[model samples]
Target: MTARWKPNVTVAAVIERQGRYLLVEEQCPDGLRLNNPAGHLDPGESPAAGCARETLEETAHHFVPTALVGIYMARTLQPLEGQSEDVTYLRFAFTGTLGEFDASRTLDDGIVRTLWMTIEEIRASVERHRSPLLLQCVEDHAEGRRHPLELLHVDPSVAGAP
Candidate 1:
């Protein structure tokens, strides 16, 4: 029997302040690329919590997710040096205010730096984005597209339910 398909699940924080959106510049397999502070949902945590953790780890800034921006799915198949397989990603995007920064903390591996960019600037640099979700999440936040955080319900059976 063929194995069941499972797309990667990730959480992202869309933090905007003073007319700019926060983004992380990370070193990808191809090269350095820009993306929202996002990462895979770790075991035993809710998506919102995961977003907050990833944002802090990547940008050194604390993030409190107030609302869900949107859920997105995308498939990719890029040629590698040898071989590669098609991959799909399911992203849960959130928008929230950024809290204090931990200046003494170090960023995660592959994270070169963190910077804020205007929507126009982000739009013009699509080629440098780690994935299309980067622009999509920013645009959605700009358009005032957001759902209540209560939209996501985690049952008690799930580990670390809060």
Candidate 2:
């Protein structure tokens, strides 16, 4: 039988303060790469809530996801060995206001540092991006592309205890 197909679900925070966008420099299989504060969705949480949690964990900052930036779907052109099937990603990107930084908190492992970058700078270094979604999400955020949080409905059945 063919292996069941599924896309990885992820959430990201596209946070912009002043003219620079927030990004995380992290270690990846290929090398160190830049990406928005993002990660896989946990077992039981709304996409917005997932974004908020991931942003905080990865950056040590409070992020309140106010709007959905966009839904992105991309397939991996090549799969690493030992994979059972093609891999795709369903990314829920959000635009939000960042709150107080917890300097006392430690950033997630594999996260080297968090830095702010201008759009031009981001565009110039596409080679260093962790994924294309990194730049696409930022560009969409800069273009005023946002949908109401209501667009995503989280059923109560899957709402795990906080």
Q: List per-prediction Cα lDDT, in the order shown.
A: 0.93, 0.91
Report the lDDT tens digits of candidate 2 across residue range 1-162: 998878899999999988899999999766799999999999878899999999999999999999999999987543345443456889999998899999998999999999999999999999999878899999999999999999998988777654
Which regions of candidate 2 fall more than 4 Å away from where they truly are?
A: 77-86, 160-162
**In candidate 1, which residue ranges exceed 4 Å CA deviation?**
78-81, 160-162
TM-score of each: 0.95, 0.92
RMSD of each: 1.8, 2.5
The top-ranked prediction according to lDDT is: 1
Model 1 lDDT tens row, 17-84: 89999999999877889999999999888999999999999999999999999999989865477676
Model 1: weakest 10-residue lDDT segment is 76-85
- In candidate 2, position 45 carries an lDDT of 87
Q: How high is the lDDT of residue 22 in model 1? A: 91
